[model samples]
Target chain A: MPKIKYIEENGKEHVVEVPVGWSVMEGAVKNLIPGIDADCGGACACATCHVYVDPAWNAKMPPMGDMEETMLDFAQDREATSRLSCQLKVTEAMDGLVVRMPKSQH
Target chain B: MSEQIVIIGAGQAAVQAVTTLKAEGFAGSIIMVGDEAYPPYQRPPLSKAYLLGKLERERLFLKADSFYPEAHCQMLLGVSARAIDRKAMTVLLSDGSRKPYDKLLIATGTRVRQIQVPGAELPGVHYLRSIADVDRLSPEIVAGKKLAVVGGGYIGLEVAAVAQKRGLEVTVFEALDRLMARAVSPQLSAFYEQAHRAEGVQFCFKTGVEAFEGHGKVERLRAGGKLYPADLVLVGIGAIPNVELAKEAGLTCQDGIVVDRFCTSVSDPAIFAAGDCTRHHGHNGEEIRLECVQNAIDQAKHAALAMLGKPTPYREVPWFWSDQYDLKLQIAGLSRPGDQLVVRGDPATRKFAVFHLREGKVACVEAVNAAPEYIVGRKLIADGTPIAAARLADTAIPMKNIV
Candidate 1:
């Protein structure tokens, strides 16, 4: 399991280990972490599971697909490293991956 | 003393309200009443992944068993809410107890519309709505078995896809002329009709079921004045909103439990309703009752806010998805009249999108195996973005660039 770090907008920190093949959105949702609503359950249909990836881990992660890039535009206050956590699959190489939640997921 | 909040129906909307209320610092005593024996779970995959044996039963649950108790909420399982007492602010349950509340939420959702025909109650006849429904029909989904499907809507087509993959002889019966007639455009319907046929699934157009004929079990269906042999029958015609409780309670029930933009009941201030059981006005000033997960989750949040004394109008874009085989059909925005469609990619390629434009503004989008259009199209619908028809139809320009 790759341990992932999740930071909420309120500056709350939660470090949890996510099993391989599970999504980062699942990592937050299954562990009862607040912030990511994930209304679609990792379908990539709803962008409610929006997150800001750490810039350092951007190059090490899989390139954002056309769908993820387009869906990111739906999230509020999107940035350069904005990604839909549902599209980010957990991997051993992504150990210690850091993701920050937006102010809200509405 | 803390306030008392009561939520009826332990599904997507019910769970969402419980989680949101706690997250928003509501110290009220929450009581969730559900008729099912299991916890609240996701129902979308029940027709697709779970039916095909790709997903296990445990994955259907929306939350773990421990999550509910940890939130300090009361769970009333295997109990149906019989009626609502608006005057007393109490809910009458099947267990003969009146659960009083300071705030009440009616998230009863919808029930599968049972087909009223002869031999309908025979064994092997199933409807997929809850976890038990799928479990009951799981064993009959064997190879070489004839499966008769009623209705060509999303659930019917999705189950057909799964049955086809599992080596079942599947045939869909739709009263309409095409597949998913009410939900998708004619172009997309034709595409799916062909796609399913190519994958060895049969379809019956303009066919209406007359009866289900068999001895002690459903072995054939009488439709279009013809008898079709079958070992199993799946009814996916449609659903009726579970609004009898509200109707009996004297709440304004018009097609569903009528609510304001804040998701509060029109008849009472302390009562709220969400999900498929709600009939509320949209941002466009039109009345609508949505049945998808998007409405369930978002409207539940708004209802939670209203219960927390932070009432905000619930107005947002409507979106839905259907996964069949390797193809994903995503739709955004509501249906409208007098809208013209512009095809983005060729259907022959099996990767395309249809953009519905009304007065040069994007009204709705139907994307098949094309996620970018569905994702970007949602924003266009939300922003009311206007664009040239030629530009939208041109494959050379990317969806993001067009906006």
Candidate 2:
């Protein structure tokens, strides 16, 4: 399992050990963290799982797919560091990864 | 004593409501009653990836078993809500329990609209709305087995796609002239039909299912005076909201449990409704009853907020998606019959989007394997952004610059 840091929009922080094969969205959701909605359940069909990846850990993340990019545009307050958490699957390299929630999800 | 909140349904809406209540620091006891045996599970994947056996069964559950107790929510599974006693503010359950509630949330969702004809209750005849439904239906998707999918709607098309991929001989029998006639435009219907056909799925449009003619188990389907060989039959007609409890409790019922902007029942302030069971006002004063994950989750959030004494209006643009073969059709907002259709990309490329505009404003967009369009289209629909049709249709111009 890989440890991930999730930061809520209200400045609350939660650190959980996500299964390696699980998605970043699932990591937060399964831990009962109240940020990522993942309304589509990692299908990338909805943009409610938008999160701003930590600037330092951007290079370690999975490249955004066209579908993820498209859905990201639908997310509120999207930024350069923004990414759909569902697209980022947990791996050994993603340990200690930090992501911040948007003001609100779709 | 703290407030007693009872939620009559254990699906997406119930789980979301419980989550929101705990998150918002609501100090109360939450009780969830569901007819299903398992905890609150998602229905979207039941007809798609789960049906294909690609996704794990545990993934279907929205939350873990320990979550409810930690949130002070008691989930009463495998029990039916027999009645809602408004006078006593209590609910009678199938388990011979009467639980009193200060506030009640009706998230009973919907039941599969069964195909009414002879042999409908046959063992092999099935409807896909629950985890058990798919569990029983999954083993029937054997190679070389003939499958008759009724309705040609989202569930039907998704299942047909999965069955075809698993080597099942799939045939879709639609009562309408075109596939998904009620949901999508004619162009989209043609595109999806062509896609399914290319993948070896047969289509019988304008064919009404007269009956399921079989003995002990489903063997064949008779549609439009013709009998088709069907080793297993899937009825994907539609769903009917479970509103009898609300109606019996003296709540307004018009196609769905009628609720206000805050998801509170029109006649009872203490009773709120969400998900597919409730009809809420959507865009343009149009009352809509949506059966999708987006509506379930968003409306549940609204209902939970209102339960916490914060009534916020839910005005989310209704969005839905269906996966068939390689095409992922994503739709945002509602489109009318006379809305202008604009093509954003060439259909020949197998990746394109159709825009439905009302008075030159972006009303709805149906994107097939075109996420950029669907994503940006939702924003346009929500903002009511007036469009430049020429720029929108130009492949060179990005979606962000169109408005």
Interface RMSD values for the candidates, listed in order? 2.0, 1.5
* Cα lDDT of model 2 by residue, B1-403, tens digit: 9999999999999999999999898898999998999999878889888999877888778886778999999989999999999989999999899999999999999999988888788889888998999989998899999999998999899999999999999999999999888899999999988989999999999899988877788889888898898999899999999999999888999999999999999999999999999999986569999888888989999999999999999999989998887778899999899999999899888899999989988899999989889878888889888887777899998877766
lDDT of 1 by residue, B191-296 (tens): 9999999999998899999999899999899998999999999999999999998899888999999999989999989999999999998756689998999899
Q: What digit string (tens of lDDT, one per residue) describes model 2 on residues A11-45? A: 99999898887789888887888878888887878
Fraction of real interface contacts that model 2 preserves: 0.64
What are the clash counts of all predictions, listed in order?
0, 0
User: Candidate 2: which pairs clash?
Assistant: none
All candidates' lDDT scores?
0.90, 0.90
lDDT of 2: 0.90
Across A1-106, the per-residue lDDT of candidate 1 in tens digits comes to 7999999999999999988877898888878888998888877777899998999898877888876776776668998888999889899999999999999886
Model 1's CAPRI class is medium
In terms of DockQ, the best-performing candidate is: 2
Among all candidates shown, the one with the greatest TM-score: 2
DockQ of 1: 0.51
